[model samples]
Target chain A: MVKHKIVLLFPATVVEQPFLYHLVKDYNLIINVLKANINPRKEGTLVLELAGDKENYDSGIHFLESRGVKTVPLEQQIVWNEERCTQCGACTVICPTSALEMIRPEMTVTFNGEKCIACGHCLKACPARAVEEHY
Target chain B: MKVNRTYDEINERIKKGEAVVMTAEEIIPFVEEKGLEQAAREVDVVTTGTFGPMCSSGAFLNLGHPMPRMRMSEIYLNGVNAYGGIAAVDAYLGATEIPKTDPANTNFPGEFNYGGGHVIEDLIAGKEVYLEAYSYGTDCYPRKKLGTYIKLEDMNEAFMFNSRNAYQNYNVAVNLSEKTLYTYMGILKPNLGNANYSTSGQLSPLFNDPLLRTTGIGTRIFLGGTEGYVSWYGTQHNPSVNRSETGAPRTPSGTLSVIGDMKQMDAAWIRGVSFLGYGVSLMVGIGIPIPILNEEILRSAAVKDEELFAPVVDYSQGYPYGRGGPLGEVSYAQLKSGTIVIHDKEVPTAPLSSYPKAKEIAEILKSWIKEGQFLLTEPVEQLPSADSGKKLSPMKIRSRGEEN
Candidate 1:
């Protein structure tokens, strides 16, 4: 089985569609949502970790694109500036997944992008403005 | 046992390589092992440090006198505005000022790419900043306007004159509502998702001092990097805050206003920061050396995070004015553990202040003292310990025939 972390952007018109349900029912894929900002009559975004057969996952992604949804990987999104960070550890607490942490003795803040859920909590919490979200 | 080493005596010992010095973090364990009386006699100096975002900080600069001298009524540095009301050649740049590109009324966190704090950082980094000024032409000095670039070294006098800093202790923040919060305390997650505190805890200057005994006016300190002096009691300094038996405040109290020359400061110790959807502020590095004058001072400096307690306030209730009340008191050790329990639910904790940097500053100060490069200064003036308890009166319109 292959696992992929991706974001599904739904245009305001497609906000009512149950795209996530179809992934589990029709595509036979496991969907663990990391974040969801779906509101009626508004553009919606869903970040999910999908796991299934490689062929099934590929087909599911193709089906999502065919339905006028935009897909982007999590890697292309966030920027963490280490030079400007004072290692205050403000971002580590609000991080839903253990993406950010403070190292011992020196009290430096370390970020592991692989574990990040992209909740954007650190963006505001940071007094140094070291964390930035491009998308 | 009476232990008293005057500033001159301490300086003499330092010169003779006989003075004993240690960081506040290091002296605690030594005092615990040797007892306060012994430690007080042996340890000459205890260095205290704190690295945090000090919003009430700024710098005053005296740029060179321009030809055909003009009174600068308007000034901008690196595209950020500076207050030119002081004098024709001097200006004050605030730390939290929003840049001209993003005026206050613009929108949420409007394009705060650079600000006054950034300009200060750039200046200290030895970068040239564009300066622009406008003034009404005067008969004695008829220059109408001027524009130029200025470097820190080129300015006649540049000093950080912070009106308030080194807070004795502060509140820990949390959000109880369904929505999140962004504050100087860092981000507070919804439904107690997280708690944010901004202090170095045991390593903070005020944390070590507890009471305002040794850290009064004229106290020499390591501000940024160069030597600085505590000028006065900071604004809103409430020494009357209720405290625990150990002397840690249950509320905000005892603050210091300090001044230091920018020529001696290093850019690495000063920085500009922008809070997302909030505003810009300065990240300052301050280190204070506390002399072990007696057993009382030694005991106070030995206080640890586990023994000190702070209130976890709910900021979602309306920030500073919120009446949601304190959830509970927790020690710095518990908060530093990365997780806290609020209302019987597990919540993670984050710190806005850099304890590692605070430790680093203390180490730096210790080295300076050990090498006899930094000397301790006895306070020239004692800080006021009593609160005036005076209330601010609101402006009222005069009634007909009233106060004729």
Candidate 2:
């Protein structure tokens, strides 16, 4: 059996005792509060660190879903449109995840698929609508 | 009294059963009702101003002390986010560039230089300009000329958004801080100097300035060119009552009203010497209009009785004094400089009584107005005459007759 440590972050509004009561009762996983200061507009994400069998790790995904928690497996790919892209560096600046970085000297941009969190921050920030998330 | 009196003599028509043909005095209610309905359709225009440096050039200046002899050309070349508008910037480039491969071992240079300049022009001219700046091992110089031009455009956009965004963001942030300071100073005193959390989990600040402490809230709007900045300091409250019997008031009504109040309280509560600044500055050609209020006191004093009705000549000199008060000239100068500092420290402390320049401008404008060169127009329209209701009916009748 795989031992996974899953951490969930809560927005200030959801910190009430009633919400915690239902959450603690439903999940067998341990919960850890994130201490970093967060902007009110930002949505909180859960971080799960798993160590052990792959099968048990996969089962944990279903457990999270049963409690109405949405889960998306992260992927690494550069989705670009040949027609709409204008090669502006706006996506590079607004990407909180740092998935996109503009290469200096040439002033062109490059994407690091591995570092991408698929947050869609780049998409919203992009004026050209050139970037898309590939599965 | 005199034979059979006309219906006009009976204090205008006042028919009881035939739906009274009300005279002007009697139709006051109907007229007022229509006026009220018309007033409802009128749009309320609220405007504020901001002043700040935005974009890479501005950002560089704001980061620290001002730089001397900074040429516009240098800023255009090196500044990031240089372009004025995003739409203009987007028309010039491609998503990626084709990497140049080496024959030996098939190891490509880490830098993806497609070789050429004016790539943006090429892209716009229906040519595909695929140029990437990154490489695996070595640094890529994917067309140095293309990057130089593109950088200029980016810098312009950066300046546009930075200036405008900063203005708005700073206003809200400062306002938030002011509200928190007041709550802690007033209702929860003894702990006046101590910091505390608001009902909402935000911190408050205890202000050191006595003037700021006494004033529940203070707001200053500064307009410099097209850029504007607003700074507000004080307790968080909706409709920020100027005067109240009690210092504390009940929670205000409306969605986000409480949130606004909370932001103010929290901002004040945090007490970490909060300061926020935001405003938009045009990059290239856009010019913002400046509004000057025409005060009756200033106008009346400036214009001589003899010149009031004359065909005013040379109104330019008189314009300044006619609009602004004693500080009119100085304020105008400040507006042109494109910078307004609202905080106590930021505003000049020099006594206006002793300031010669300010006095000089005021005197000049005052003289011009007195010479009958300047005229002041009414800021608001007068109420319609009592006979207006009668005129409206006739006009409607005429229109209907024409249609038939």
Candidate 3:
């Protein structure tokens, strides 16, 4: 099974639709919503991790795009600036998935993008501004 | 054999490229294999380092006067306020000073993205910083206001003078409350989910000389990747705290007031940091070479992490309400082990101080001494001892407006 972090942008038109429920039931996928921000009658943005077979994952993306919802890889939006990181490990506690983990013995902080769910916690939680989110 | 070497004797060997030096971490194993006497007789200097957020830090800038100088009464750099009370062209910018327009906590958990610390970092990187100054027109100088861009090289003189730094030891902050706590200690998860600590453990400079035997006024040090000196005993320096048998303070104690030329400092060593919910602070890299004059000094310099202990404080109640400790005391060894048992719960632990960077700084300082470029200096006067009757005083609050 493949798990991918994707962000879904819902226009005001589709804000009331049942999109996540359909993705799980139709594609046989496991969906974990990391964060969701919706402005009443304006727009909505969702960050989620979806796990399924490769074919089902592709079909899920096609299904999402067909519903007038914009899909973007979470990796394309968030950046962990290694140059600015002092490896202080302050962001490690704030990160839920241990994505920003400190390498022991060396005590240096490293980011594993695969484990990140884009909760947007480490973006401002980082003291160095090393974690940036473009979206 | 007894070893009683003086600073002059050590400097003589350093001048001729014959001084033996080791970092604080390296000295531990060396002293373990060879005894303290042997290590003391052989090693000339033991270097120590710490890279952490020191909030009581700032820079003094002598911004060259504009063509029509007006005895500037107000000044700012990069939207952050600088203390303009010093002189017409001189100002002191503190690390935590945020912009006046910053929406600080009006919206809870404020994001202080930029501040004076960023300004200092930019200045040292040879980047242009926007400067704005205003003045009430004076007879000698008529210009009412000035706006210009300035660089570090253009300044008359720039120096970093931190009031308190290199805290000998600090508490391990945790949260016992049901809700999370956003603190200067970093974020503390609810119900003691995690613990956060700073200070480079054994590699910390003050921890090496717990009693301040060698580190004192006028002692040379590596500050922000440049040579600097201990200006004084730092503010709130309380050496009379609880201690271990080896003379290391189990609680936070002696601090150093350091000064260095900002013109010579490297941008990599001085960085701007923002703590979520808390304001901004400056992360400074400092390294001090402890002259191993005798076996006693060598023994102290070889102090290991296991011997160092810090109190675990609950930031939600204990830290903010009272300065009471130690939900339980844990050694640095336990702290570095990734988790600590607090109230029967295995809470994960993390350090705000970078051990790798601290080691890097210690290695760099060791190399400088080994290369005959850096020499040791005797402290002009030693810091006050734990038995010196020194106490950290608190401000007297006058509810009736009774002036002190």
- Which of the numbered candidates is closest to the native, going by highest DockQ? 3
Cα lDDT tens digits, model 3, B83-183, are 98878889999999998888977887898989999899999999999998899988887898999888999999999999999999999999999997888
Model 1 lDDT tens row, B1-404: 48876778888887787889888788879988998888888998888889888889999999878889988888899878899998788999998887676865357544455788888889999999999988987887688899998899999999999988988778888888897666666656689988888888889898788777788899999998788899998877877767777777766677889999998898878888776555778888999988887888878788888877888889888456647678888988888887789899988787788998899999998888888888888888878653444222434679988873
For model 1 chain B, where is the 10-residue window of minimal lDDT?
B386-395
Predicted candidate 1 versus true structure: per-residue lDDT over A8-127, tens digit per residue: 889987788889889899899999998899676598888889999998999999999999999988755667888778888887876667688876545679888778778887776666
List the DockQ of the predictions in order: 0.47, 0.01, 0.73
Model 2 per-residue lDDT at B388: 25
Per-residue CA lDDT of model 3 for A9-46, tens digit only, reads 99999888999888989998899888899976679999
Question: Which of candidates 1 and 2 reaches a greater TM-score?
Answer: 1
Fnat of each candidate: 0.77, 0.00, 0.71
CAPRI docking class of candidate 2? incorrect
By summed lDDT, the worst window of 10 consecutive residues in model 3 chain B runs over B319-328
Cα error, candidate 2, residue B392 (Å): 52
Alpha-carbon error at B194 in model 2, in Å?
Answer: 36
Q: What lDDT score belongs to each candidate, Candidate 1 first?
A: 0.82, 0.24, 0.91
Q: Mark the regions of model 2 whose C-alpha exceeds 4 Å error after superposition.
A: A1-55, A65-70, A76-83, A133-135, B1-404
> How would the candidate models be sorted by TM-score, starting from the highest?
3, 1, 2
Clashes of each: 0, 52, 0
In terms of lDDT, model 2 sits at: 0.24
> Deviation in angstroms for B1 in model 3?
6.8
